[model samples]
Target: MTKTDLRHRDVAEAAASQPMLQQVERWSAINSGSANLAGLATMAGLLADAFSALPGELALLDGAPSERVSASGQVLETLHGRHLRLRVRPDASRRMLFTGHMDTVYPADHSFQSISPIMDGRLNGPGVADMKGGLAVLLAALSAIERSGAAGSIGYDVLINSDEEVGSPSSAALLADLAPTKIAALTYEPALPDGTLAGARGGSGNFSILVRGRSAHAGRNPADGRNAVVAAADLTLRLAGVASPGLSVNPAKIDGGGPNNVVPDTAVLRVNFRPAGEEDVRHARTAVEAAAASVARDHDVAVEVHGGFGRPPKPVDPAAEKLFALVRECGRMIDLDVRWRSTGGVCDGNNIAACGVPVVDTMGVRGGAIHSPDEYLIVESLAERAMLSALAICRIADGGLA
Candidate 1:
């Protein structure tokens, strides 16, 4: 074997030897759902402790102020748990950013709280595949790179946020602030069950539209009363009607209703949009505003629109293609074939890509059935993916991307 191949094999073996499965089992036991502040805190503490093995200045930063529209149509501030940030070799000329999410879709009271071995080396549990396993892979890879003494020249910052499954409403600013400083980025979101990565992801936006109408007695003055619920329903239909091949609109929920004796005065319509490109995003915003105006005018109700596109579309530009090629080359070095395809799913990678940084987002374990009770992690992928990421990161530190 060539010298380079031998070196890669050494790093891969080192990465494969990490205690990733133990870490995944231990971490997945905690429920760090996006909305569960207490659970997130516990998870964050454990992550901080685990990541302390690497050389870095670690700290827990407070989450940014986030707002949400209540079912009563009142806008209120929502609290999120702290985010973990670690900076290593900050003064190095070459810098990279690594990001992951500690939060999962499972809530504190979720039923799927235990981990068990399933068929074909799969481990079924909450957050095991969605990201706790990814975190373990990240830590193992970085630790392996450090052991190989290849990270001295290239610095990197690690950001693990508590709110990603919920659109990263609280941690978006942190991502924006740190993305531009990095030459490249790697996000530890799980790959497909077959180990295929996500590429050129579509953009996503969530909005909550509040409708207000005059309430009146249903029996005596029904004709004079404006029904907010009816107006909200009309808005949902109009929003969904604007969906096309490139843009998908999902009107997830509508909150507002009262006793039959009285006309409902307030309602909130929650909708989500996925746009394939910048033009699609513009079209979607315009469609929403126009539909809201039409609904208000037709229903004689006041309409208020809240929320904007949090994740911008990530296209496979030249820079991104270069990054993907580098990852593919690294995969080949370790006798692994790495490929990617465009997906409708959105993640912190979308936000990082918006800042002009080329990021390979799915540098995590191979798993399937994410965001559901059937979530499972391919146990062997812990070392396999760690080796992949470690080799890629070391190559970048060696000026592969430059």
Candidate 2:
């Protein structure tokens, strides 16, 4: 066995059950919904306090600028709370990046708040699996490596963003800035229920197409009216048919319309699409534009399309596969089996991979039912995943894998 193997085993064994569960319970208690600015600010402070245990310069940097259309159709920009950044061993020969999110899908007022023990050694609650639990695992693994005195061999930055659950519109730029020249990346998005990892994620984009047309009194001059609502509906149907083996399109909702006596003059069609790769993304965009233009021309309306592909596809390149192999090796050392498959969902890993960085993003606790009230974390995987992550980092630090 290599010296790296021995050290990793020692660290993994010591790393488990080092207040990791308690930290999860504590952190999961707070509500850090993506749109809850106050809650996110408080959660950010809590993260700063918790991650301060590591050896690094910790800073709470301002979140990136993001814009959204208000209910009145006015475009407005909003600022989120600070995001956590910790730089450890900045001058080390090798560097890696670690990322996790502090936000959940549940709003502050949502009723799903408390953590309760479920059957089969699982804990059910909001954010327990969809990533507060993952953050706990990351801290435990890093603590073990730091205590082993091997942290200096591998430099890394831990980014805990407060806006990941909302497609990371604000944090995307921050990730791009930090991704250059990184050898590998680990993201603590929860593993699948059976502990399978996410590999080769498809890229995702969100779009809002606004339509404007001439309104008329339906009872008096129905022929003179151009219906924007009908135009939006036509566009939705056309876009849904654009999905192919390489692309998935979803027309989520439409907004607009009024009383029966009036022809609706304004409407917005909201959509989401997942593409297999860059070419797929390009094709999907072209298809959406052509469909929208056809609908507008037929309905005599003006259409404005907004938003583009924010998260790029993350394919399992050779470098990424090597990292996965190392993770599997560590899993075997700890008597854990690790499997992976391509995922339709996208995350921060997609953004990191777009920078030419190889990333294994599902390096977190095993769990299921994410983004729902039934979300849960397997109690045993807390320690198991921590060990796996610590061992993998140890292998990377020892130059066994790049």
Candidate 3:
């Protein structure tokens, strides 16, 4: 009846009829955990084919070799990973980045790879919510934009990184390179169950502390041995408090030490942290390094804390605030109520934003149970998200309200 009404009708027509759900199901069924290098390669190939088939400019960046060198000089050259980039329209000065990861937390051995049939209108799978569903939604929304004949109005670049689950060790450079040139970015990492978006995200870092201590006979000279496990335990306790104003420190895993007999000579502490700002991240790192050194000195052990902030914080800058406000307005235009919240949960978006691009991190459809068998996407939001993203793309490329 009216312009707004007609627009809504157009959005509905554009989104309601795609094989997008099938795409989601297929992707979710393939466990692409970064640890499963083989599976990730397969998924990357699949994504390449999908992108190649799209009626747009697409490029499959050559795989890069990322090596993990052990203390023993053993070099573990990880699988050569591929990243896909697809561009719609062209405006180099006013660019946008749409980021998502093709990798999930499920490994090749995980039993959560099955995509159950529609139950209560929800499809369940390993990555249905975590992100495979989001990828499908990306494709569907792009297709809808294509059909809307507004494709040329939205100049966007879609980047699907293959190694997000493992801290994105290899793809960070690409994200950085793309971020500096983009005006805004939308990361399809699913919204909350209530359909609220992720406002600002904390920066993330992964660290591992290896302690080396002298081992001695348990019964004969237990006192003569320096216990690396003890040093690690102390360090962990201290590292637990690294969370300050905008930082959170978490010692997730610790390993080493055989039986209770001989004094333990080795310990490995694996910890992860997230910061809300650059200073927060630096403070957390300082605290971690200080704690490690103190513990090692006190326990007569050699300790090493090696790692850096992998993804910098996507602070609540004016640009990001503008993005959220725009998306909210976009929701209003589509008759959907949308909200957002800041969180410590990091994603590829954080990595993207670190490159200085403003980004709305939760552009995916509302969903829950990410990384679990119970994962599901809210089917009702499929069209809502697609329309919102497409509309936003159009506005941004049109040089307004991005």
Can you write out model 1's per-residue Cα lDDT over 9-39, one digit (the tens) per residue? 7887899899999999999999898889999
Candidate 3 regions with alpha-carbon error over 4 angstroms: 1-12, 55-57, 62-77, 88-91, 147-149
Please give the TM-score that candidate 3 achieves against the real structure.
Answer: 0.90
Candidate 2 TM-score over all chains jointly: 0.97
TM for candidate 1 is 0.97
How are the candidates ranked when ordered by TM-score, highest leading? Answer: 1, 2, 3
Q: What is the lDDT of residue 23 in candidate 1?
A: 94
lDDT of each: 0.93, 0.89, 0.76
Candidate 2: misplaced stretches above 4 Å?
A: none
Model 3's alpha-carbon lDDT is 0.76
Predicted structure 1: lDDT: 0.93
Across residues 1-402, which tens digit of lDDT does each residue of candidate 2 receive?
777678778998877957888888888888889888888888899889888999989999998778765533456787776789999988888999999999999998999988986677999988999899899999999998898886668899999998998888888888998888788899999999899999999999998888888789999998899998999999999999989999999899888888989998888888999999899999998998899889988999998887789889889998889888988988999888999999998899999999988889999899999988889999899999999998888888888673
Task: Choose the strongest candidate by TM-score.
Answer: 1
